[model samples]
Target: MSDTLGAAVIGLGMMGERHAQLWAELPRTRLVAVYDIVPERAQAVADAHGCLAASSLDEALAADGVDIVSVCTDDQSHLQPCLAAADAGKHVLVEKPLAITTADCDAIIAACERADVKLMTGHVCRFDPRYVACHDAVAAGEVGDVVQVFARRNNILASGLRIGPRTSVAYFLGVHEIDLICWITGARVTRVHAEGTSKALASIGADDSILSLIRLEGDAVGCIETCWIIPEGSANSLDARLEVVGTEGRVAARVGGEPFEAASASRSSRPDIVYWTEVHGRVAGALRDQLEHFADCVLDDTEPIVTPAQARHAVQVAEAIHHSLDTGAPVDL
Candidate 1:
């Protein structure tokens, strides 16, 4: 067995809690501490896991024997904690949509490089069993030379409970599909055109849904549709579909099944049936596997599967989509 690495998780939200749980269970990791702006939440997780709850970022960084830090905070909040962890000489795993902007991601990468720390972004879908299988099939030329792709991720508003209106669907929902598309095809996005609407979530000051079309450098075309306006009680769904048209043949799979059902009520509202559990839970195994991989990289002195630079490119693509929507024109990357 590898030596246990003491780890700290910042941000005790749903993702943070999940990371703590996984760290507790992973034989190579020990959850030494947890930190959250909300002291109570951090304390709760620490207590449950027999660890400490650092009251501040400095305390967490200064804690003795912490070798790894996991940043599970909001997109905007990732920069500082990540920098501090790197400066403290700890390997860092940051949750994805690296940051709200490319500049922020660059800064985090610079900090990690300066500190000589291993930095891995949380593009956990690459570790997912289904996504892994799909990637393998594509690698074996099951799809031949890829030609076109389509992917979608949708969920009820319940999953949005912690996410505020300020968060865009492109960043929160679209980033996953964006990363997956690029990973599956091994091509760079060259141009993007997007449109978004906020009929139900206008009050939240964010477009609740988005549709995007992207042109890849290799002439492969892709589309992504994401939303969070489904009713509260409706099943939370993460619908992902990928179709790879190659010169010789084609391969495809739906990440989750779509089920149709009817509900009768006086008001008679029809809700879309949700197909996935919590978005995080649907990908929990992936998250755990990714963390283990990060640990292995640290132990073996190997590069991470998802580098900060690649993560920055994903952010760039997402930003391009946002720009495309705002300008009503295709944005070239």
Candidate 2:
């Protein structure tokens, strides 16, 4: 095998395109093939990147030089591509919220395990410097005995309008915090009491906002706020914050309020510079770091930082949150 791995992206949406671009740009990986439900979309991406525009999932997996598959399908459509990738003997790097349900998550995990291939979910928050620093501080005892955690991730109305019709806000946004808080505190969420409102996305059968009160394994508690109904005039497309309060001290990270702001006649904006951004004519940031990490792990034959079980834990917690919302009562895991 060559030192550089070849990658295939299975979805051509925003995230999938980013993955394809990064694989082409990254040092240890090369974009070899791409596939989307729309052949024209796949062709456009392939033409831009000089890769094959596969007509089907099997063709994409079988494309010459392909070693890894990046699954960036919709929130509810991750299982089939993941299973197919494993069957083709390729490593997988899937986007977060591994699946909408725990059973689907298990099936994907089992398939990869059976094929003896690497599997890593794309929990990009884990790769964010802000969250990484906070996790490190808590792990270093700077925050001593965590008592509680609070996380908020809100996006502009455009996001709600674009994604609400397809997926719930909890799975789309809250799952990031669900996985992040558990990772930072090193505890499992034991129970959850969740409530949701549906003013903005009610017509689409999606919630505008979801708030979850979570109890962890060690009795530490957390509050998670996820909404995508912020007005477009807001300074940033994303508004997120995470704070961990401990017996001795506290640590927190804030987004949407970056100092780098650009103002225009109509509105002032703070464009995203952390997740994925064009820098020096190429995509760079946490998302790039994440893809690089997955490629490196596959090349070195090592386990990924974001393990399948850890990803499944997030789904389990999400399921509990939905259950709580349905029952209008606290649910125990």
The collision pairs in model 1 are 235-274
Clashes of 1: 1
Error of 1 at 273 (Å): 17
Residue 161 of model 2, lDDT score: 93
Candidate 2, residue 263: lDDT:
95
**TM-score of model 1 vs. true structure:** 0.90
Q: Write the per-residue lDDT of candidate 2 for residues 234-276, one digit (tens) a residue.
A: 9998999999999989999998777889998999998889899
| TM-score versus the correct structure, for each prediction | 0.90, 0.99
- Candidate 1 lDDT over residue span 108-219, tens digit each: 8999999999999898778766676777888888877788888887766755544645578788878888888888888878999999887777666777788999988679
| Ten-residue region with minimum lDDT total, candidate 1 | 268-277
Clashes of each: 1, 0
